[model samples]
Target: MPPIPIDNEGDPRLAAYTSIREKDLTSGHGARFIIEGKVTLETAVRRGRFALESIFIADSRIEPLAELLARVPADVPVYTAPQSVMDKVTGFPMHRGVLACGLKGEIPDPAAFLESGVSAASTLLLLSDLSNHDNIGACFRNAAAFGASAVLMDAQCCDPLYRKAIRVSSGSTLWLPYAQGGTGLDMVNAAKAAGYEVWAMTPRTDAASLTSLPVPARLAILLGAEGPGLPDEVIAACRAVRIPMSEGFDSVNVATAGAITLSHVFTAAV
Candidate 1:
C-alpha cells in the first residue's frame, strides 16, 4: 500500500494516533493499543496476531521502512507525516519514527486457556497485583525466554500491551499467550483444577528454597508485585518457593527473581 500523506494532525484518519501518551495512561482507547518503536511495530506486523488498524510513520522513515510497510494489508492505512507533525500528533518527540495502532480481541477465559494445552504444557506463570508496566513487560519477556506455555495475571496487574511494557518486552507481549482478569486465588485454583501444581514465589524465611524443591510435571509459578509481595493467604494456598540470596542481599527485582526461578524450574523440568 502506498503511504498516505498526513499533513494535518487532526485528520480523522489519524485519530487513533493522537494524544497517545494520555490515552495509554487513561482508558487505552477501549480495545485499541498504541505500538511504538520500529521493533515492536515489526513484531506486530510479522506476528499478525492482533488486528493492525493503521500505521503512522515519519516521512523520513517511510523510505527505509518501505519493504516492511509493503507487508501491511492494503486495506490498512499507512500514514506518513514530517517529524514535526508526527511529534505534534503523538505529543512527544517521535524518536522511533514508527507507531502502529492495534485492536485487542477478547481475552480468553482463564480456565479454558489453562486447560487448552494442559497435557503438553509443563510450565505457566501467574502474576498477581503487578502494577508497574516495566515489571510486567520484563516478566513477560522472561516468561517467553524461559518457554513458559502461558502467563495468567490477576485483575490487579497492569496491561502488558501498554506501550512502554510492549517496548520493554521487545514485543514478547505480542508473541506470548496471556490471559488476565481474576482474583489471585481464582487463578491459582484454576491452574490446580487443570492438573498443575501451583507454587507461590516469596522471600519469606519459612519458604522452601527454589533449588531444593523438585519441579512438577505440570507447574504454575505465582509471582507477586514488588514491595508488598504475595499476600499471606495466597502464599499459604500454594507451596511457597524462594530464591536463596547472599546473606547481605535479601531479594531481587520481581522480574529478576521470576527469571531465576523460571530458569531453575524450566531446566529441571526439561
Candidate 2:
C-alpha cells in the first residue's frame, strides 16, 4: 500500500501532532495513552499495548523507521512528511522522523495499586511537592528500577501525564502506578492503613535513622520534593526517619534520594 503523504501542516489529520502536550493529557475513552518518539516507540510496541493508532514519519528520514513502520497494521495510517513540516507538525525539534501513539488498558486504581499484587507489598515511593517534570519522570523510572510498587504524590504536585514528564520518562510513567491527593499526610495515612510502617525521610534529629527502622512484613518510604523537603506536618505523620546522608551536602535530588532510600528500605522491610 502507498504511504499517506500528509504534506500540509493544517491538514485535519495532523491535528493530534500540532499540540502534543495537550493531546497527551486527553484521557480518551478507550485506554490510557502514551506518545513515543521513534526509538522509544519501538520499545513500547514490543512491550504490548491495547492499540497502536498510527505512526507519523518524515519522508526524508523514513529509512531509519522503515522496518518498524512495516510492523504497524495495514489499516493503521502511517503519515509521512518532509523534515521541516514534520517538525512543525509535532511542535518540537529532533523528532527523528517519527512518533507513535499507543493505548493501554491496565491502569491501577489509586487506593489499591500499591498493594504490589505479588508476595507482600514490599516497596513503595512517596512524592511530596516534587514539581519538576524532569525530576518526577526520573523518579518514576527509578521507582520501577528499584522494584517499587507505586509512586505516590501529594495533590499539589505536577501531573505525571504532562508532556515533558512523559518524554523525560521515556514513557515509563505508563509502566508504573501513581496517584496524588491531600498531601504527604494522606500517603502516610494510607500506608498505615495498608499495614506498613511509614518512614518519613527527613534530616531532623528525633527521626530514627534508616538503619534502625523495623523489618516490618511490609513498608512504605516517604520521599519529599527538592528544596522544602516534606512539610513538617507530613513528616510528623510518618513514624519519623532519615537516610543518614554524609554531613555538609544539603540534600540530594528527590528522585536520587528516593532511589537510594528505596534500595535500603526494601532490603530491610521485605
Give the per-residue lDDT of model 2 (tens digit) for 1-270. Answer: 446888788888766677574455435445444465665566555654336667677787577767776677787787788888877776777455666655544444335554554324576777777789899888888877777776777766776766467667776676566766665676678777777787788877778877776656667778777777888888777777776777775477777777777777556544
lDDT of 1 by residue, 1-270 (tens): 789998988888988888888776324334888899889988998984788889999999988898888889999989999999999998889998999998887776567677676335789888999999999999999998998978999889988889999999989888788888778988898888988899899988898998898788889999998899999888888999889999878789999999998999878867
| Clash number for candidate 2 | 0
Global CA lDDT computed for model 1:
0.87
Steric overlap count per candidate: 0, 0
Checking candidate 1 for backbone clashes, the offending pairs are: none
Report how far off residue 181 is in candidate 2 (Å): 3.7
After superposition on all C-alphas, the RMSD of every candidate to the true structure, in Å, is 1.8, 3.5
For all candidates in order, the CA lDDT equals 0.87, 0.69
lDDT of 2: 0.69
Cα TM-score per model: 0.95, 0.81
